[model samples]
Target: MTKFTLYLAMAISLIAGKVSAQDTTFELKVKLIANKIDAITKEEKEALKVEIEEVNKQLEAGTITKAQADEKKLQLAETRSKNIETRVGQAQEELKDLVKQKVDGKLKEDYRRKFSITFWDGGPKDDEGYKKYRDSINNNRSERRTTSQFVFAAGVNNLVTNKAVAGSDYRYWGSHFYEWGFTSNTRLMKNNNLLHLKCGMSVMYNNLRPTDNRYFVTNGSQTNLETAPMNLRDSRFRNVYVTAPVHLEFDFTKTQTNAEGKRLFRSHESVRFGIGGYAGFRVKSKQILKYSEDGHNVTVKEKGGFNTEDFIYGVSTYIGYGETSLYLKYDLNPLFKDNAVKQNNISLGIRFDLN
Candidate 1:
């Protein structure tokens, strides 16, 4: 049985064992009626907890979403709550019978044991053995070396110039980037959280805005940011990529011992740092130019090859506590194909290890 039920039964047993035959009948009726309510409440609560735990397992297994689990739990709580009130009313009727039996000296003092044992729902499936079995299974979950979480990051986007990660020729605040993906982190050492290998597939959207009224231009196999012929209100360039990233992460979270004395190592519970890189092909590129023409606003979107590198590779790193981290990445490959002065892409951002 659950701790709540056991403690209650113990208290009632103590009181009942000490009560004398000289005790008033009215006092005995009140004690027995209240104990009946407590016993009923405990049984309903235990059953409801079992149902909700199953829903949570389904959510973690990806069989149902979090919303569904919440809904199921709410429904079970409401049902059990109503059932408690209804059953308490029925137990009150038993009090009336007990009153009549007591007047005739037929209400046996041994009836306390009946209430105590009945609180278990009366079997191996519903007693202390069942609770112990469930607890053992929980503490001895199947061994798993890998776990997964959703990842998303966003921040300013610019290029490294002369080894500095700054937007030298581009608008610093206007350029930005966003990354969203799923990652799996695998433990490298048995019963340890110090090191892990993190790998993932991500889609990246990197944007750049040139300063001094400039926009990207393509000439044959060359691409450069050139001064626009028209005074532009906005000039922006965007690149998209599907990249696979791998990182060697060091997690400093302490390993904890469960009730069964087994060690449990979980990720993202403390300070963590990761150093790794990504490699992938540029999926697409585009340029946007917005200006006023003859007192009317005009927006132009140009989609082309732009002579940007088809394949790209980059170095990235992050360091922080738990779910939030400072993220930085710099592309090692040249931005354009065979340029005399190669320009590389760089980005600084905030990442969320959203599970």
Candidate 2:
């Protein structure tokens, strides 16, 4: 009976020892898992602290405002919470499965915490990330460059009156003349102050005709011969001129919102006014005449008196609307010798702007 009792006591003691060892092993695994979680949490806290510091630096540098910083911080906190919760939940589930299978569970939680910490810690920093982001935004907000323009024009001139030489008893005659030429204006300045410089060349052709009975003698007192009919001659003149002009203009316009729900700006659109001057030089001149001999038409070469003057001066003014400009010019130089030539040029023309 005593041997039977001793064997039973030994069996019970052996079972108690096994139970104690299993409990101790499970407690140790739980403690190791808790330690790993604590380490991960500490690492995540440090990473978050660094991230916040960078955000503060961006705020102080004016790269971002306080409101933007706060919004970013909220988003980051939400993401972090979701990530940590997912990682912790998955780790806990894996630990529970391992524990149910009676295997070591601590390493599962440790590995999960390690992955979460790595993901958060390897994220982009505030400064470099924001620079790239802002640059992308600004690149879409710039404007295009302005294009230049070229303009061209052409016209004609006709003469009206002709004067005779005094005391020469010569007949006075005039011709209807016409000139055709082109000018190109290049835009030099574009702003509230509209400035332009132009250069051009023109070719002119003229015709002259004399009247047969348009002569009168200056003196009749010393006539030793019989009175006779006066003989007259016909003449023509042709010339070419090249000119250059410079202009400075002003625009008084204001920007406003129209009633049609469109933005409108006043411009030199109607009645643009400008003041400028021009300088021109003569290029070529020629003369042709007709003579009557024995009641027959005959062509003759005459001394086409042309001056060798090389300079011309004038002032210009404009008054017009839209694309059509009406301009007037008055020559400051005499058209003939000794400044006694009652000849000054008056030009009236139209211009267009093409840009």
Candidate 3:
């Protein structure tokens, strides 16, 4: 019994020593992999910082807003994470190769087989898992997709002032104006789809027709309203703008089941509204003078600044149910640049959006 016990002790000691040596080697390999991952992460972090700093500079310069910068940061972080993961995967492959080379035949085969089972189980490639992943991706894409609407608006446009100017009366029908634009609305909150931000470009035409046979003439930097020297049928001052508008819109449209039992939520279908403003530079200006010149019926188009404001800004609001709404807008800035009168623009019209 003593001899048998002595042989068992020797065998156990040999096994323990072998296990200790293999544990040390495994720990060293783990440390090496950890160091490599750290290096990759550090390099990527530095690059990300430089890119993010450039975006911050743009935000400071007012070239981009805070929201835009935040989006860029998210994109950068996602890309950086992907890059680091790829590098770590390569490091893992290198580690596996090194282990195979350094370890003895049986130990190498055992470890290599274990690593293959542990690290390369080829995660979740079954039909069920693949279907779930694909569905998740599709849902995410649908949520992020942006929708567009074509908007058309027309109404009577006139100048609003604290006090009336001497000769600045406008004929109602003749001073009619129109606006058309294409807008895209994006939901800012994932959970709350009621709030959205809308932005787009529009073309606005403001036609001002005087009460009497009068026209606009610019002298130096100031515009003067004057009567026609001769009998004039029609005279109008036209201003055009290429503007970008931004709005915070609320969509209270509710989801409903159709005849086919499919659930549908049409945008701007229920009680919906938006309050926003626009800022844009002037595109062009023209004066259409229709009068008898040299005994012949002549139409003259005068193209110039006409002392019109170059930058236009206005507050706008819309309220209604369904796709059509009553639109109201008032310009905060003056219509004319250097005029004796401080006349601002106000308009009320119907706005339609095909969403």
Candidate 4:
């Protein structure tokens, strides 16, 4: 009974020692990884600052020409890229080591009793464990991805119509106008080659003019005849609307290497095509009409009072390159519902992504 007790004490002491050693190693590994990551981050920042300062000095001293400065910029970019790659590799290795240690410790605790052993020999091999750990680290990095963007656009619209005449002659008249809207694109999708979706809301102001024409009228008896020409003037319309648009953009372009030998995906140059629809609600509307004969401005007729419906629906098609997207939209509803004005509103404009 004494010998048996002595053997059990020895086994317990060995197991306790092994556990203490593993715990210390695990803590030390964690500290080392943290310290290394901090060191790498500080080094990367300092290197970037130094590079920028050197470029500025070169530009100020004229020792390096503009072209040479550009070349040096490329070099600095490559250096930064390489530094990032190195840091990622180091992080991956450190994580692999930490994971291996943990797995080995757990395996030993769980499997040691069954096999009459103090440590697990069946823990993941070094290479396989490293790969698994690196994958986990990459997953964490992917979760941190973010992007920013910006956009701007302007457009023109014209109206064509004829004068209202009873018996005389009909003439063609039209007016040209313009509108502008600015918005920034906030990116909502991220995979390098996948279709990206973005949405933005913008405030647009438009100025519209309606063309006018005049007709002659002859009224008389058999002995007397009189002719008079009536002067017609155009009406200018101004309105502000809030527009919201959603885009599903696809980038179909080849990745190219820049002068610095870094792979850059050129945007805006990508043959980007998107189909989107916009909904705009009128905020304010006013009409300014000019009488040609009287040479005075007059208030023209308006449809849909302020308390009524003030919304416009438009479906747009976008086909263009890069940051500039060419768009064509047709208003779904007529501008005036009560009037028999056989006219449709159409617009051609450029869309920009600002983020």
Count of residue pairs whose backbone atoms collide, per candidate: 1, 0, 0, 10
Compared with the true structure, what per-residue lDDT tens digits does model 4 show for residues 234-281?
454555667886667675655555445544443444567877777878
Best by lDDT: 1
Native-structure RMSD, model 4: 30.3
Candidate 3 clashing pairs, residues 3+ apart or interchain: none
Local lDDT at 120 for model 2: 38
Give the Cα lDDT of each candidate.
Answer: 0.73, 0.43, 0.69, 0.49
How much does candidate 1 score in TM-score?
0.60
**Model 3 error, position 142 (Å):** 8.4
Order by lDDT, highest first: 1, 3, 4, 2
Question: What is the TM-score of candidate 2?
Answer: 0.35
lDDT of 1: 0.73
Better of 1 and 2 by TM-score: 1
Query: What TM-scores do the predictions have?
Result: 0.60, 0.35, 0.56, 0.41
lDDT score, candidate 4: 0.49
For 153-223, candidate 2 gives per-residue lDDT tens digits of 22222222233233222222243333223344433433222443444443332332334333212233221
Name the Cα RMSD for model 1.
Answer: 23.8
